[model samples]
Target chain A: MKRVLMRGNEAIAEAAIRSGLKCYFCYPITPQGELVEYMARELPKRGGVFLQAESEVAAINMVYGAAAAGVRTMTSSSSPGISLKQEGISYIAMARLPCVIVNMMRGGPGLGNIAPAQGDYFQATKGGGHGDYRLIVLAPSSVPEAAELVGLAFDLSDRYRVPAMILADGMIGQMMEPVALPEPVDPAEIPPRPWAVTGAKGRPKNVISSFDLEPEGLRRMNLVLQETYREIERNEVRWEEVETEDAELLLVAYGTMGRIAKTVVRLAREEGLPVGLLRPITLWPFPYGPIRALAERVKAVLTVELSAGQMWEDVRLAVEGRTETPFYGELGGVVPSPGRILEEVRRYVR
Target chain B: MSVELAIPRGYTRVFSRPAALSEAGFTYCPGCHHGIITRLVAEAIDELGILERTVGIAPVGCAVFLDRFFNCDFVQAAHGRACAVATGIKRARPDLVVFTYQGDGDLAAIGTAETVHAANRGENITVIFVNNGIYGMTGGEMAPTTLPGQRTVTTPRGREPRSHGYPLKISEMLAQLDGPAYITRQAVFDYPHIVKAKRAILKAFRNQLEGKGFSLVEILSTCPTNWRMSPVEAGRWVAEEVSRFYPLGDLKDTG
Candidate 1:
């Protein structure tokens, strides 16, 4: 293990390289452009492929091609760019290919702002692309978690034969923190993809696509995808429960908000307020079981986020009539500080 | 002893159930140019033995369900987004032949930014652009390729140059870039012109196979139903009037 100081975006890019990814295709967009630039420089140095695609649409399609070829490939972009990539993402999911995507989310609804925003909660966790498809969305609260999640994303994507996403925001991507890098995985040790389109040798042929128009065929495809999702939900719901042993107020947050909420929890504890934090690591296949348990004991559940009220809906669903959930958020690129959250906690607890 | 050669019975028999053609039985009217263009692209893929390795991206217009017509991997992109989707596929799998089938509206209007940038980047992919001057899928609206003085749904009384913009020259504009390996403008209104269009498409596909950069073939096609003209009149207009504004010839063939 090598400990080094790195930005969240750079750490994720380093993790992608260490995971034996051979292709990086992306177009420059704010908050995530640094990640693409890092790949453009590092991929070529390591004998991998790097391309600054024509647009977000092109970048995503390039990811589809690379993923179809069965090489570890990825793309990175901000919120607006991710919107441009929706069609390609749907096709990639439909094809059931293993690829990584990093969305360093920013404010949006149409070029809302460039700063970080958790507004993409519904888009990321609840299927941003069309049709009945879900990307395994990993929300990293810190730079180290961002790097760690990249490796996990690769593993999960390959194991499930589906696309996985590392959904961060501007804060995580822009913040600097210490990260201990894992030993690089050997490219040769990774299982070979027999179905990859690597020049089509004596084999019959390999086709990767998302078009099954026959009603029965499309229905069957959707069923298979749903089954895979169900399995994921059963096996991959991850979260961190901090100090829930004797707390009355439970805070639910993820990504950047989760990081801030941690600080708020510490401050509340110092001030003698009984507060606990539930930070979801996997946004999709969300860690609802633990949250539901916490909701039962807590007096009130406070959902903190950067968006107006995106993840609050998820929190409500998880608690579901068991508890009253009040949301606190800052809209349009305004991220709440720990001080502000602490005040809200004091009001809710009292 | 005598040697004998077996020939295929018909053109339809030559194709292997196009995976790109939708099951919806084509919403296009009789004598629509989309069917011809679809057949031409499918035939080229068949002849080149690239069906398994080909990925076709359908645009948002009438041919959005191109996945139904071609028996290869297919992706349906947003309006004017075929090029972007094709770029992703090609970049991910360099060995696979990726192409986009887009209409005038999808290519020229909403997707112009994507198209221009993809061409500029020289992504190793092919683009099959069907330019019918009018937005055929939508109700005969004026398109960027709409010729001067042409009557369209948006331009009811003969398009005025002072009000409506002049016809766009997509092939010539693309040819200006050194990155584009091939750029051609062909028509499919007649048999001879159809043959030329096929050749251009085959060349574009071959370029991608050879790792040559971006290649686009702008097919000046007819839209009799949308243009409110007889099939014969539409074909004649493409040859006599449309071709005068958007010339039917190869503008640049670097390969």
Candidate 2:
């Protein structure tokens, strides 16, 4: 009912609970520890299952287990921790289990640092694990958006029977924001999971397996997964277009980078420069169509990210020579300021 | 060819295939022991009358096909992650009886983190660990439980302590942990050992049924084809050399 002033990580946890999360299995990692702490305290009180798993690998498998049993499950981790979870994530993807994963990204090629960075764009959007699969990646630009996306993640995961990841950076994970929490969903209102491995009671047994040893069987399963993904690409693309109606210069970003780029757009416009921002809310089923159409009008597009221009490739594909596409980004845990981003925009335009 | 067996009219069958075990054709190599273990698990599930509330977690290796034989619900876990998956299911639906069937490589090597932690947390679940001392699914390779001097495809020159490291006794190691209610290592090579193994399995299942904490039955099985032995030789090897290295009987029974 009332808006609660909470940290981004805390809000994400609370929002997930309201979305009827019945089980949570997570290991503590930097920039996302508060979310685990919140669940540890609240889930038990609410008569739900909460377990601090031994490692990120264990946590994801636990999510796999709970989801197989027809329960709403979630897990959270940061960059390196997320890497440890790739094996389990691939299984979850292959099994087509519906679970929510929150990746509050920190810097990394390894255990890089514990500061905010959008370094996981490629890892999140592109299949991070070894498989022919893709996670439903949602990039939330602000703390409120991050909270909202957490709920959307569970909904989408169930709707598509896929793992949906909320891609937030450390800034969004740690910063405090006033968010109006949604009303809790009644678990009874949720539809039954007929495929879950509850038991072979009065019906046929359900087996949640990824092993299809036959060549034809594996091919058939992959085809089914690819079709679902194609449908997601068609209907689930989301984005925010800010002042792009008639702008000659465009800034493309997502997650916290999108928020910083917006400020850059305002600063450039104040100096009579033609600039606007296009913040993609969904990064995997990336908004390629909108970017291609917008590229027709803009003179040039500048892609901004917290990594060394990982999302730049996607922007380039979307532009497809319609406009001159260039990129600028900070490395490791560095967050580019509005001034620095504006300077990059001036360099691109001039 | 003509001796008629005496007919006992009052004789009723004491055992048939358990109701929870389906009549699926087992694909295990002749005398692989996976069939026996699966049968024992099915018998335990039926004896406890938890078939309607039981969920089995299958491992990544040979037992990955456990779903085909178990009439109850089953979930196939990633390589070496059966224990963790079972923990999740048991925790979420506390009323269900969840168990994992894992092999040497899956339980002791790649999935050590999951296995150790799930047991350390005292998760209310059962784990049936099949230790044949080699990785059978990937074509005979050195496993973490492979005995010293044991040769396989990976260790063609025999397992050298310096190069291959030492075999890990995970059952003994896990038994020392404070969290587990029952932890034992038994064999199914002979009828007497098979009987003891079944009793241990039934007890572990009963422990989980009574809400007792972590329980695991590490069955010292034989991989006949992988060992390059006749099925008969494999059983003899399991009794002599394997039994000498990994002693039989319960290592821990806190219950």
Candidate 3:
């Protein structure tokens, strides 16, 4: 019921605290340090644990420990930092524990710069770490959505017992926006976890491990995980179909790019052109069905990204040859202006 | 008269599986010293009566099987991250006793930062380190703790200090730190050594139980399979050779 103007990083941190985040551990990286700073200042007052770990690797593993102890846990990092945390993230996935990871992404391919970029779309959607595993990834276009998704990330992580990532970019993390914060969910509303390692008091020992020596056992575990993934895909595909009815042109985007595409659509429409937009919210389960069905009606689809065609591949696959798919992007954190996106749209429509 | 009044106290069961050591059978290489050290830690936990409230973090090396062996609530960490995980568990719930069982590769090599920082912060937790001088699970690779001139799969020509650098004396190094409440290096080769190692382990655990902060016991263990020797010969080597590079005793003890 409270309305406030907050930065995306601050919104995420405050929302996590409200969501009953019992432990927050991370190292500071640009674009996302506000989240860590906020958590460090606030979590202690809430009787929660806050630690600035030695490294990204250590931070993720700390989340693993606290999550295993049956508490809400999280960590935030940038591109390079996230790269360092891949091993721990993989282990957390293998261990099947619920935790939230925020990647306020910066330009990369190797320390590209501390600026906005969507280069990590592949890393977030696809498996960044080793093995057959998936992280639930949500991309938010606004500060309010960023705050809302933090709560959703925790709920989805707890519901599925999997790690959920809030894939925000540098622009969203640093930009200020007006937002009405959601009411914090009560801890009692969270699903019960009998499997957490609290203590062995009168109960059989609980072993949380990713080590399965036998191939049969390991393969069976992957299959079970895949089954859960299938359930997630079936139930959790979220997207926005903006004015798609009777549109001759379709533009696909997400995160900061999604906002830019919205302006491009309005510009194209004002110029007497029929253009629409499809914005994906969940990056992993990529709203593929919606994109495919939309492609069936639209004349052509073009994907706009802040990186050199990272999420474009998924866009191509989702369209499935129903129409020609073109891509527009700027690498090294050079975000395209709406005018530039409108030009790309004009090439395909009217 | 003493025997007549007390019904022979020795007749009572003196030794059994500690409540911390679970019913699961440990599957380690024959003669590997990890099993012995695992039991010592469990025995320490049992003797202190902290088994009900203790949380054990297992490593990713040969000792990863600790998750199965230790009966208390356990979480398995990625290679070399056990100390960081234990730090998290302890900080979140100080009421819960937390400890980590780590191998040389996991502790001194890959996880050196986590190990050192956790210690430097004076975290109230226990660490059980097994320095076998080789990476046993990965089939005898060179470890950070491998002795000088020691032969391993990665160092077929023997460890050359010029290229490979000298073996890391992690225990000695950690002993110099100001954060540790207790630091010791013990061996588990013979009966007397085993007794001393168990005692050191108990001391480390007791220190944490009293909230002393950052106690570690580095047990100079042996990997007979990796060393290409019989279990008996491995025990002898730990006594004759391993003890030279990693001496036995309390390198540093606060209490």
* Candidate that scores best on DockQ: 2
As for candidate 3, its clashing pairs are none
lDDT of 2: 0.90
Please identify model 1 stretches exceeding 4 Å from their true place. Answer: A90-98, A107-116, A129-133, A188-221, A332-339, A348-350, B1-29, B34-36, B42-53, B62-76, B158-164
Worst 10 residues of 2 chain B by lDDT: B1-10
Structural similarity to truth (TM-score) of each candidate? 0.86, 0.97, 0.96
Relative to the true structure, how large is the alpha-carbon lDDT of every model?
0.83, 0.90, 0.89
Query: Which 10-residue window of candidate 1 chain B scores lowest in summed lDDT?
Result: B15-24
Q: What is the TM-score of chain A in candidate 1?
A: 0.97
What DockQ was computed for model 1?
A: 0.28
Across B1-255, the per-residue lDDT of candidate 3 in tens digits comes to 112244465577555777678677888988988888888888888788988888999888887777778778999898899989998788778889999989999999999999998988889999999999999988999999888888999999999989998899987888889998888999999899999999999889889888889999999888988999999999999999999877789988889
Clash totals in order: 22, 0, 0
User: What local lDDT does model 3 show for residue A201?
Assistant: 88
lDDT of 2 by residue, A138-180 (tens): 9888778887888888888998998999999889989998889
Cα deviation at A244, candidate 3, in Å, is 1.0
The superposed Cα distance between candidate 1 and the true structure at residue A57, in angstroms, equals: 3.4
* Best model per lDDT: 2
Ranking by DockQ: 2, 3, 1
